[model samples]
Target: MNALKHSLAGLAAALLLAGCGALPDKPARAALYDFGPGSTPTATAGAAAPRALPMIALAEVDANSRLDGTQLLYRLGYADSNELRPYGQSRWSQPPAQLLRQRLREALSAGHTVLGPEESATIARTEGRLPDTLRVTLEEFSQYFEAPDRSVGLVRVSATLTRSQPGGDKVLAQRSFTARKPAPTQDGPGGVKALAASSDAVVAELVAWVDAPR
Candidate 1:
């Protein structure tokens, strides 16, 4: 009987100890954002025909520290212009480089024959000559706030067109593109929407530029 009482006491003591640490509050869920589904641009009447450059390859996008990761980045006014920050509870579905490359491929495919890096490489192996290639480096992609309440999605990218040459690949043309669109709301979703619009706008202009006379 004494032994049974001792075992019960020990059980009670263990229960009391287990209850000492109040269950930690669950952490808030992280929000994941992306550009969502994008469609190929429709060909317009009287618009310049597709560029005669044949199939072009899209190299993996390059990015800096601010854009190299998956976290959604932002910045304050001109005072904190150099201070880049990221949202703790918000993140992108993939790295910015990957997202940009996918968007670029989808958008450019409408008006041009765009092959991925692998595709271009395979063609070069068999055909002895690869087509032109478009290499883009994303300099910035983030939400910028002019004031506490006003914000916009800002994106900047530099693109270069290269083609096969006797010695090696030759750069045909290169330029930088920047876009700023007012955010509908001062949150990640707003920034995402605005950025997507800005991206499409840039893609449209780039496609036209490629087909334009040099």
Candidate 2:
């Protein structure tokens, strides 16, 4: 009976060891991604200072609840376009609105003096003059799959430009912008690259629109 008990214990110990070996030490973590570093100056050495650009007060970008999270979302046109799904192992480093705002600010900085809403208000109080206020609303941002293997990164936004006056603020311009870029692959990384490209395109359009005579 003692020998039998010893044998059963040994078998149990071996099974325990086998089970431990089969299990992973830690669960896999989701990959985090963001828009890549924007355009870099060609040469900093002896480079001329950039000319003064128009100053504009950029308000915080707004978005719907669906885009307020870090989940990397996608839609299947072939299956059910209305149902948005999240990738299992991928996520944005920040919410889509924040990411778009950062990218837009960076791009606009190249040709404008971008200021926050609070900063603009302070300047208005001190200088008695306010720069035009720009408000943006993110309407759509996602990877859209037309077919099982074909996809594109899609983005849409609405922009409103307003000027402050003694009486009240006046709307100067309002427009909607959309951009789509084909994904290099049908995976998360590819979606990220495509979205970044689409965002850059949209930013360029916004800068041009703002710079145009108003």
Candidate 3:
């Protein structure tokens, strides 16, 4: 009995050691990125900086369910327009919608009191005035493959500006903006850089368009 017990203990110890050795290594961490222009804005030669429109509330940006996540998405080719793919080890710092909304808010805040939906309620209560509404829907935001080794970053968005009204909301203006930037390296890093540029360009255009005369 003693001999059998000692053999069983020795076998258990060997099995434990082998299990530890067979454990797999940790996965490679995903790389995270954000949008940026990477330089200070140059002063424009103009009169006094135009005053921001009273106040603008940015509504929650709507997007396709797949694009709402942080995963970096890509397309195989134009032939597969409806098919989307995600990179295994690339991701945004935050979900794409949040990132896009934050960028829009920052750009608009340059001269306006940009508020989220929750914050806009306070304005209505305190001032008896509801601010103008800015609604955006992301159409496409991903890296596209033109060929086996060629790609570009593509971004498309639709924006609508609505004014407060007695009976109902009035759409002052709305437009769609699309931008594409060719990747320099045809890989994850290049895609991220190109996407950032496209994002920056569309944001600037959207802000200007929303404030323009109809």
Give one digit per residue, the lDDT tens place, for model 2 in 9-102.
Answer: 9999999999999987786799999988887768678877766776999999999999999999999999999999999999999998899899
Q: In model 3, what are the clashing residue pairs, if there are any?
A: none
1-214 in candidate 3: lDDT tens per residue? 9999999999999999999999998999999888854445788888687585778899988998878888888897856957898888989998777788888888888778888898888888888888999999998999988886788889999988898788989988888999898888777888898888888889989988877766
In candidate 1, clashing pairs total 0
Worst 10 residues of 2 by lDDT: 43-52
Question: Model 3 shows how many backbone clashes?
Answer: 0
For candidate 1, the per-residue lDDT at 182 reads 90
Order the candidates by lDDT, highest first. 2, 3, 1
Which parts of model 2 have CA positions greater than 4 angstroms off?
A: 1-13, 22-25, 42-48
* Candidate 2 residue-pair clash tally: 0
TM-score of 2: 0.91
lDDT of each: 0.82, 0.91, 0.86
Residue pairs of candidate 1 with colliding backbone atoms: none
Using all chains and alpha carbons, the TM-scores for the candidates as numbered come to 0.81, 0.91, 0.81
Instruction: List per-candidate RMSD values in Å.
Output: 4.9, 2.2, 4.8
